[model samples]
Target: MNGNVPASTRTLRVLTFLATQPGPVPMERIASAVGLPRSSTYHLLKAMISEGFVVHLPEEKRYGLGVAAFEIGSAYLRHDPLERLARPLLAQLVAEIGQTAHLGVLHGRELVYLLKEQPPRPVTLVTDVGVRLPATLTASGRALLAELPPAQVRALFPTPESFVRRTEQGPQTLTQLRRILADEKRQGYAVEDSHITPGVASVASAAVDHAGHPVAAISVTFRTDAIPSSERFLLARRTRQAADALTRRLRG
Candidate 1:
C-alpha cells in the first residue's frame, strides 16, 4: 500500500508475482496483484521490458518474464555459495567417517558433483568433482530428489528412458524411483549400494534452504564391507548431521 517504496523493492515484488503465474498476465491484473497503481506499474513494466526482464505481448495485451529473468535465475544457480560453505564440512565429514565425502546438486535428471573429500587413506571412487551421475542411482541424487514434490519428480523423469542405469542395482522406472524416494523421505536420508560403483555404498542427506527446498546433498561413500552393518546407521546419522549443518549455514 506504500506507493513511495524503493523502485528496486517494487520491481522485485512484481517479478516474484510473475514467476508464480502459470502464464503471462495482463498489466491490469499485475498492477492489482502487486498493489501498484496502473500508471506506476506501466512505468515499471516499460523499464523492465526495455531491460529485457519482462516482455510485452502486444497482441495479447499481457506481459511475461523474458530471457533476462531466466539468465538471472541461471546466474543464481551458478553463483550459489553452496560449495564454498560445504567444503570444510565435507573435509570434516570424511575425516570423521573415514570415507570419501561428496557435495552434489541436482541438475535436471542428473546429479553433478561439486566437491569431493577423501580420508587420509581412501578407497578409489568414481565420484569426483565435475562428474555427473543418474539421479535414481546415487545417494546424493536421491537425497536431493526425495525432497522435491512428486509432480516435479514425475516431470524430471517423464518416461522409462529417462532412467539411466550404471549397474543393475537401482530404480529403472518411475514407480520404483518413487518407492525409493518415499523410503528416503521417511528415513530422513538416502542410501545407494553398488549403484554407481560395484562394492561401494553411499549414504546422503539433503541440504535445504530457508524455504525448505533442497539446494544440494552431502554424502559419504565407502566400501560396502568397510563399516559393519550395525555401524552403518551411525555413518548415515553423521552424514545427515553434516547436511543439516550446511542447511543451517545457508539459512543463517
Candidate 2:
C-alpha cells in the first residue's frame, strides 16, 4: 500500500470537510479535520485558493467555497447527458400525470429549476425554466435533502434562522425541516402543497448518483384539488421511477 496520500485525496478531504462544516472554517480547523500536517494543509489551501475552488476570508482568516466550485457544478447541468435522456421520460411523466413535470438541482441552499415540461393543457403554469426557489420550502428540495447525510443536511441549514419561508406552509425551523426530511425519506417521496402558491401542489423524488447522493429531483406540480386522492400515490411513484431511471442512466 502507498504510505503517502495522493494530492487528489488530500484536496477532496479538505473540500468534503468544508462542505460538511456549518460555516467558513479556519485553516487550523481544516488541518485538524483532514488530519494533515499544518504546513501541508497551508500549502494545500494555497493551491486550492489559487485554483478558485476555495476562498480566504480576509476579515476572519477563514475559508469558504468559491466561484470556480460553482462553475464545476454548473458544468454538471450544462453537459449532463441526463437532460437528453430525461426529456423523453419527463415527457411521459407529463403526459401520464396530466401536469407539469420539473427537473431541479440543489445549488447551495436553493433549488434551481433546470427543466420544466408542461402538459398539453389549456391552463399554463407560472413556473418556468431557470427559476430559483427556497429549497427548504420545495418538494424537489426535500427529495434532494433526503439523499444527503444527516450532518450535511444540518450544516446546510444550521438553525431556525437559516430557514427562509417563501410561503406560510414552509418549515419554520431546523427541527421542523429535519422532521420533514425524515418523513420524505420514510415515504420515498416528498410532498409540497401550497408552499409557493395557493392551490398548487407538488410531489417529488430524487435522482441519486452512484454514491447515493442526489444529483437532482423529478417532480409533478399541479392544482391540489384537481388531483384525485387515489392518484396521488401513483403520481409520486411515477416521479420516483423517472428519477431512478435518470440516476441509473447518469451513474451507470
Candidate 3:
C-alpha cells in the first residue's frame, strides 16, 4: 500500500498480527490490519497456508496459525527462554510459601520440569529439572492440559493406555479425565493429592500466551499431613498469582 516494503517484511507482519489475535479471522481483516491490498493479501495468505504457517478454514472462510508456526514456538522452547523467565518467580514462591516449587511445560502427552526450587526445610519431591511425568497424573501437567481445547485433549489421551499411572490416583478414562480437567478449569487451579508421591500434594496454575494457550505451569508441592484443606486454598491462590505474573512476562 505504502512505499514498497519487502515481501519478507510483509509476511512477517502478517504472521505477527495473527499471533496476537484470539482466534481465526476473515482474510479481509488481516489485509486491512496489515495495510495490504486485498489481492496481495490473498496471495500472501495462500502462500503461507501452503507452507503450514497459516491454516485456512474453508467452511468459515478464515485463517489462523498452523502447525509450522507452532513448530517454531516449540523451537523457541528448546532455547529455554521460559526457564529463564520463570526461575526467579519459582524461587520467590519457595521463599514465600516455604514449599518446593517447580516450573513445567507440556511435552506431547507428558510434562517436563524445567526448574525446581526447594526451601530450607528439606522437602523431597520426585520431580526435578529434566524429569518427565504423565500429564494426567500431575498437577503441573493438569493445569496446562485444562487450558487446552477439548478436541486436543481427546487427541492426546484417546485410550486407557495413554493414562500412565504413578499412583492409584488420577483419572483412568477419557471421560474421567475430561471431568477432572473441567473441574480444574472451573476452580482456577489444578491439584494433586498423593498423585505422584504418597503423602505429598501439589497445586498448580498455568501461564498463558497472547493467544490464551498455556505456555507453562507453576506448581508448589508440600506434605499433605502438614497442611490442612483450608491452607491449600491459600497456596493455590499463590501459585495462580505467580502464574499470572509469568503470563504477563510472556505477553510482554
Candidate 4:
C-alpha cells in the first residue's frame, strides 16, 4: 500500500483483486480493494482493458478479468505441475490402448498440445507437444470446447475465417461446429477422424475442474483401421476414465 510501490506491482494487485471477486466490480470498489488512488486506478484499468487483461462492462460500470487473463492462467497450468501429473496417466493410457496419447488445452481458437505419450508401436502423429490445431477439427479441441459456455464459444469463433481447416474433413462454419459440440455434450466424449492427419482417429474427454469447467483434454490417437468399429465405445470409455482421473487430481 506504500506510495513507493511500482506501477507494475499495483497493476498486478488490481488484477489479483478482480480474480478473487465472484463477478464484475465497480471501479470504486476495485480502487479501495487494491489501495490505489481512484484516479490512478481508473488509468490502470483503462490500460489493462486496452491490453485485454481486463474487461469493462459499460452498462454495469464494472470491471472483470478478460480473456487474456484467462489465457495467462491457462498458460501457467500448461507448465510443470500439469505436465508432470499427466505424464504417468498418459503413459498408462498408452500401455492399455497401445496407441499414442496427448494432453491439450484450448488457446484462443486452437488446441495446443502440452504432452504426448507413445506406445512401442506408435502411429505417426502430428500432435507432438507444442503443436497447435484448429479446435473444431480435433477431438481434444472439441472436448474442451464442448465444456465452454455457448456465448464464450461463439466469441472464440465469431466468423468464417475463424474456422481453420487442416484437412477437407471437419466443420467449416459456426453451425457445423455447434452441431458437433452438441453431439460431444450428449455423448460425454469427442471423436475426430482424419481431420488433423489422414487415417488417424482420436477419442477425447475433457478434464474439468470442481466447477465443471474444462481445464484440458485427454486424447488417444491411433490408426483408424487399427480400431474396430465395435470397440470404439471401449476406447471412449477409457479416455473418459483418464480425463476423470486428471480432473480428480486437479480438484485435490
In terms of TM-score, which candidate is strongest?
4
The C-alpha RMSD of each candidate to the native structure, in angstroms, is 6.5, 5.6, 4.4, 3.6
- Displacement of residue 53 (Cα, Å) in model 1 is 14
Candidate 2: give the clashing pairs: none
lDDT of 3 by residue, 1-252 (tens): 574899999999999998887677899999999999999999999999888788777777888876567557654763568888898999998989888999888877888888889998758778998898998999999999898766457656768988887788899999999999999999999999998999999999999988898889999998999889999999999999999999999999
Scored by lDDT, model 3 comes in at 0.87
* Models ranked on TM-score: 4, 2, 3, 1
Please, what is the TM-score per model? 0.74, 0.76, 0.75, 0.80
What stretches of model 2 exceed 4 Å from their correct place?
1-39, 42-71, 78-80
**Candidate 1 C-alpha lDDT tens digits along 1-252:** 595789999899899988777567899999999898999999999999898788777777888776567455433643547677999999898877778999888777788888889888989888888898998899989998898656457656769999996788898899999999999989999999999888899999998776566788999998988988899999999999999999999898
Across residues 33-121, which tens digit of lDDT does each residue of candidate 2 receive?
88888888899999998987877776677887654664466458645575786787789888887789998888767888888888777
Cα error, candidate 4, residue 108 (Å): 1.6
- The alpha-carbon deviation from the true structure for residue 69 of candidate 3, after best TM-score superposition, in angstroms, is 7.0
Model 4 lDDT at residue 9: 96
Of 2 and 4, the candidate ranking higher by lDDT:
4
Better of 2 and 3 by lDDT: 3
The per-residue C-alpha lDDT of model 3 at residue 109 equals 82
